[model samples]
Target chain A: MLRLPKFEVKNPSTVEEAIAMMHAIDGEARFLAGGTDLNPNMKHRLFTPERVVALGGIEEMFGITQQEDGSMRIGAMATLANVASHAELGLAYPALSQAALLVSGPQLRNMGTLGGNVMLDTRCQWYNQTYFWRSALGFCMKKDGTKCHVIEGGSKCVAAASNDTAPALMTLGAELEFANATGRTRMPIADLWQADGIWNKKVAHTELLVAIHLPKPSADQRGAYGKLRDRGSIDFPLFGIAIRLDLDAQGTIFDAALCAVALQARPWPLKKAAALLCGTKPGEESFTEAVEQVAALAAKQCRPMPNIPGDHEYRHAMVSVYTKRALLAAANGDGPVHHV
Target chain B: MRVFRLQVNGDTVEVAAPEHWTLLEVLRYKIGLTGSKQGCDKGDCGACTVLLDGVPTLACLSLAATVETSAITTIEGLLPAHRANGGEGADPVQDAFDRCGALQCGFCQPGMILSAKALLAKNPNPTSQEIKQSLSGNLCRCTGYTQIYEAVVLAAKGEQV
Candidate 1:
């Protein structure tokens, strides 16, 4: 049995109360809503916080609302099941809903949160390990060691982005609402991330991720997410892609954003691929070319170590496969019109 | 330690719980509800799957303190003691599993049956593909998944296969 290291658990009913407790703990505390990610990490001794602030009681953090302007504000504690099943979200953003539904398994989706998924701890086969295994491996750069075993002599930790929602949200251009004892602020999803594994999120320790706001897609926009995993379900993506394309009245691609997960330290956007779509007609050849370019760039950006689930070559190949599928799904047309 | 209240096997009991103990540990070690087995302590294996608020979730991945107010129906309580004398009866799902020969060593049967019951309750006419997808997280080394899938379908139709 994996016993959690000694810690004090505090349950807070409001965001303000949670923030105050977080402030008092001087960042030694970790806020927990759905313990899906944190509990396992703690069991592995990857983190053993002295105090854990439980956020389950904060009812304000658990619903989805679509404003008059059409943008959706999802409370940080909203379960993945809620996000996947919300009629408004499904009707408006099938891509996001599909991504949410594809995560882990039914049980995990019911328990995990969009907020938790967004803030998912950066994963590495080397880093996301049991204490005994890490001890035998002499520890990795993401945890105890000063140097990274994944890329020896590399300056930064190269933990893979294990999150399923990050790429989907990134494609949707969501904004995150971060709260702390002092105040709250919002930022585009792109700005919220850092490529380096050591400091992936830009938020301060005192700042809690309160909600995720996804701007409604334009009338001409259509999107989809595709994931490739070894197992058909319950496994994290070996490689995954999320595609959001805004088309002109003529159906020509006017703007595009592509994000791939399990590729780098965070959801790595393929600007080159998006650029490739600029003026090209939405067709199979262009999609293939873009997927190829993204695959090559992702391969350059990633160096899969022996610790993760799939081999480096396999994961690299899946990038091309998943990206192509995602682009094709987006081009086929999906929205409220198509009950995805 | 906090005094955690749980509605386990149709009874309400309060026990002192650690801040980070999983529901599996609480059920197995503290309350002595040993029917819910713990295989992979991690969420991967379905050995510790249980119905939390009518949804199947890995008990190994759940914190006991969080489910203090939630309704939990474990395997042991699935069958009422006087099921034979029933006006109100045992779950049809359990009866189907028995008729379909769904267990051998029986280690994974409880969790498998519980997950199936959760699925059939919602989607009474699930396709074979849906049944497999629903049970994908649960690894049953025995039965080879054939009988279990049949059991779920039969149970959903209220038939003894």
Candidate 2:
């Protein structure tokens, strides 16, 4: 039986109170969202905070509301199920909806929050193990040991970014709002992550993610997401691709964004591939060329370590295959953006 | 210890719960409602599934203090309601499961039945694909899900299980 270690839980009625409580705690503490990721990690002893500031009681930090200018502001506490099933989000940002829906399953979706998904911990086979399992293996740099198991004698941890919604949100150019005891700040979602696995996110420990701001979708905008995993559900992505495109009046691709996840410490934006799509005519010949170029670029840019399940080489190859599938779906406006 | 007032199975019960106690622990150990099994204890398995405000949620991941305001309905709560809803004396979901031979070890039954009930309540006539998607969170090690799917379909049609 996996029993949670004893810790004090602080429930605050508001975000301001939560931050103040977090600041007041003398020992190490963690913000508790849905407890989907944090609870499991706690059970594994990967995280052993002395105090937990529970955010579920804050009423202001929940729900999805549309702005006057047509954009949407999603509170950090909004459950994945709520975000995925929201009528506006489903129509405006299908990739976001699909990514949220594809995360874990129904029961988890009910408990897991959008904020938690966006800030999900980077994962690796070597690190995401029980305390006994990891302790016996002589813990890696991610936990307690000196060296990285994935990249022998490597200085930095190379855990893959396993967040499913991150790539999709990056493709849509989403922004995040964060608050702390001092003040509040907002930044583009792209700026939230760094390349280092051990300290992957740019957000400070004191800052709490408050909400996600999604810009209104243009009439000509289309987006899609595809993820590669062993199972249809519950498993995190071995590799995932998200593509967002804007077509001009002439139906030519004017702007495009491509992002890949589970390949490295952070989702990599395939700038070269998006550049190739710009001004390209939407046709079989153009798509084929774009696919080839994007695949080649991804294969060169991504260095998939043997951190997760599936053969590294096979997973690397699927990056291109899935990218092409996502681009095609975005262009064609398909329902099932996700592929096995 | 904190005393939380929870509406469980139509009863307003107050229990002294620890700050870290999950709804699953409170239900099984404290409240003695063992119908909701603790399978993985993580959210991966649906064995600890229960209805929180009419929506299926994992009890193992839900904090007892956080969910005090909401009505919690466990598998045991479904029985009388199911009978009242013209289930012919037995709970419709349970009757369907028994009639369809949907259990081998019967460990996954409670969660599966609740998931199916939630689905049927929202979408009475769901397609095969929808049924599969709805129960995708549930893991049945014994049955291959064919019988369970059939049971849900039968229950939706109001047929005797």
Candidate 3:
């Protein structure tokens, strides 16, 4: 049986106290939300922090509130189940709901929080491994050694960013609220990620993601999210696609945002696809071409590691399949209001 | 280390454990509640399924500290009489399982039953596809899912074996 490394567990009722503890412990401390992801990673000896500050005790970070602006402010610690089952979220942001529902499973969604899903560590077949497996392979850049096993002579780590919610949130132009011992700051969701794997999450070690702010969707706007995994349940995505479209009275696509997840340091906005679909009607042919183009572009940008779960070649192929499905779903204007 | 007083199976027990100790470890090792077995340790398998505040959860993955104010129910808490006394001679689910030979070894039955109980509590009537989808995380190598689906359907309708 794998054992969790020894560490001091601290539970703070308030976010301020939690931030202070993080600052006092410095980089030796790590925040624990759902632990659905962090606990397993810790058992693998991926991170041996001296202190684990439990954020699950903070009640203030566990609710959902609607702003007067028709936008919603979701507490970072809100469980994925709460987000997926929320009536307002299901109505306004079907893309976000779809992403939330796709994570792990029903039991995990009940435990995992929105913040943890959004701030999910970048994964690669090579990096998301057990200590024994990594040691046997002479270690990769994201872990102990310098050589990147995914790509020889490559300058960066090729760990896929396996976060499913990032792409959906990015497509909706969401904002993030971050807090630390000093104070808090709000920034666009797109700026919160780095392409680099080792430090894909751009937050300071002390700062906690406080909330996610999603703007209300316009009346004519429609969006959807799709993911490709080896199996339907409990598997992380090989590739994920989220597309949000704003249509004019004539049903011509006016504004389009396309995002990709689990492929880079963070959710990457596909600017080229958005530009291609800007003035187009996104008919059957146009949608197919746009999906094909984005899929091809994603294939070119990613050098999937042989490390994760499925075949790297298959993952590349799924990028096309998922993108095509997401575009078609958006074009057809058929997104489920909620899963259950 | 923190000592929490929790009511498990109608008994109030105080367990002294590390703050990060998961409820599964406490239930199995500290308190000797061995019915909740650990198959996958992670939340992937329902082998360690238990009720936290009446909601089914993976006890192996749930930290003990998180349930300070909530009620916890384990398989041991459900008496055999209770399982048999569902307005019938024997619970339709168990009777169907016995008739259909749903379980060969019975290792996964406790978790599978509890998960089914949780599902039926919320959705008394569910389709065969819904039952399969809900129980996807619970793996049973023996019956190959033929009898489990029948057991769920029979239980939902309160029919005799």
Candidate 4:
């Protein structure tokens, strides 16, 4: 049995108090939300903080509200279950709801918070192992070891971004609000991710993600998400694709956004493919051409290391397949917007 | 060490434990209610599932101190209150599982039952797909999930074993 390493827990009733506590503890503390990820990671001996500040006690950070403009503001402490079951979210942003629903399974969705999922640690087959297992292999660059096992003599870690909702949120142009003892700051969700695995997020250590703001989708817009994995349930994605499209009255794509996950350290946005998709009419020939261009471009942009599940080549191949499917789903306006 | 007052199975129990103790550890070790099994000690497995304020939550990932104010219902608390009124039988979920042969090893029963109960309480009539989705977190290695799905269907119809 793996036991949680001993640490003091401090419960803060408000966000201000939590930030003050974090400041007081300085670098020795880690904020606790759902603990679905942090607890497991801690049990693996990946991180052992001196103090854990429990954010679940804060009542201010636990609900979803809508602005007068039809946009949505989601508290960071809201559980993934809440997000998945929210009627407004399901109707307004099916891609986000479906992404939240596809995260792990029922128990984890009930416990994990959207904030935690957005800030999920990058995963790798070599890094997400027990201490004994990792020690036997002499470790890797993600931990105490010197060299990366995934890439021979690699200079940096190539852990994959395994978060399911990040790509969807990025495609929707969401913004994240972060707070600390000093003040508050807000940035686009795309700006929050870093290309390096060790410091995967661009947020400061002292800052805490407080809420997320998503703009209301226009009537001509649609979105979808697709994930490939070894199992139908409980497995992290080997490949994930999220696509959002805005069509003009003539059935031509006016704007498009595409992002892929679990293929690189950051969610790789397919800007070239999206640029190619713009002004394309919705039809078999245009769709096929767009897919071919996307596949060719993604094959070059995506650099999957020999980490996580599935063969590197197979995973790369599925990236294009899933991208094509996601584009079709978004164009057709499908429900339960994610495909496995 | 911090002292916490937890409302478990309709009783207010006070326990002095370290801050690192999970709700699963406190319930099984401090309170001696071992019905909630620790299968993976992680959120991936639903064996440590319980009801927090009527919502299904993973107790293994919940901090004992954080949930002090919420009502907790474990497997041990699933006894039908009608037993005191002379209404006989186990909870409908348990009875259905027994009659439908929903267990081969019985290790996943407690979590499965709680998840079913929570689902039924929310939606009295769930489709087969809904049942599978609700229990996705709970894994039964022995029963191939067919019997488990049948058990939930039978339980939803208020059938007895």
TM-score of each: 0.93, 0.97, 0.92, 0.96
CA-lDDT, candidates in order: 0.79, 0.86, 0.77, 0.85
Better lDDT candidate (2, 4): 2
lDDT (Cα, tens digit) per residue for candidate 1, span A1-340: 7777778878888899999888786448888877888888888988878888888898888789987888999999999889988987876676788788888887788789999998888888878789999999888778877878777788887777778788888988899998877788889999988877865888865588889999978877878878777766678877777788888787778788888777678778877777777665576466556656755665565445543578878767556556666777777864211111
DockQ preference between candidates 1 and 4, better one: 4
Where is model 1 chain A poorest over a 10-residue stretch in terms of lDDT?
Answer: A331-340
Instruction: Name the 10 consecutive residues with the lowest summed lDDT in model 4 chain A.
Output: A331-340
DockQ of 3: 0.50
lDDT of 4 by residue, A16-49 (tens): 9999888786457888889988888888888888
Q: Candidate 2 falls in which docking quality class? A: medium
DockQ of each: 0.65, 0.76, 0.50, 0.77
lDDT, candidate 2, A1-340, per-residue tens = 5777778888899889999988887888889999999888888888888888989889888989999999899999999999889998988888888788888888888889999998888899988888999999999898888778888779988888998889889989899999987788989999999988886899876689999999988778888888888877788888887888888888888898988889889988888878888887667588668767877787787767798878998998777777778788888876445553
> iRMS value of model 2?
1.1
List runs of model 2 lying over 4 Å from the truth: B83-88
How far is A179's C-alpha from truth in model 3 (Å)?
A: 1.1
lDDT of 3 by residue, B80-117 (tens): 53654555344455566666677877777777777777
For residues B1-161, could you state the per-residue lDDT of candidate 1 as single tens digits? 77889988668989887867888989988998899988878777787889987898889878887788788878987887337447255578888888888777888888888889888878889999889978877888765588889888888888644
Instruction: List the candidates ranked by lDDT, beginning with the highest.
Output: 2, 4, 1, 3
Candidate 3, clashing residue pairs?
A125-A307, A125-A308, A161-A262
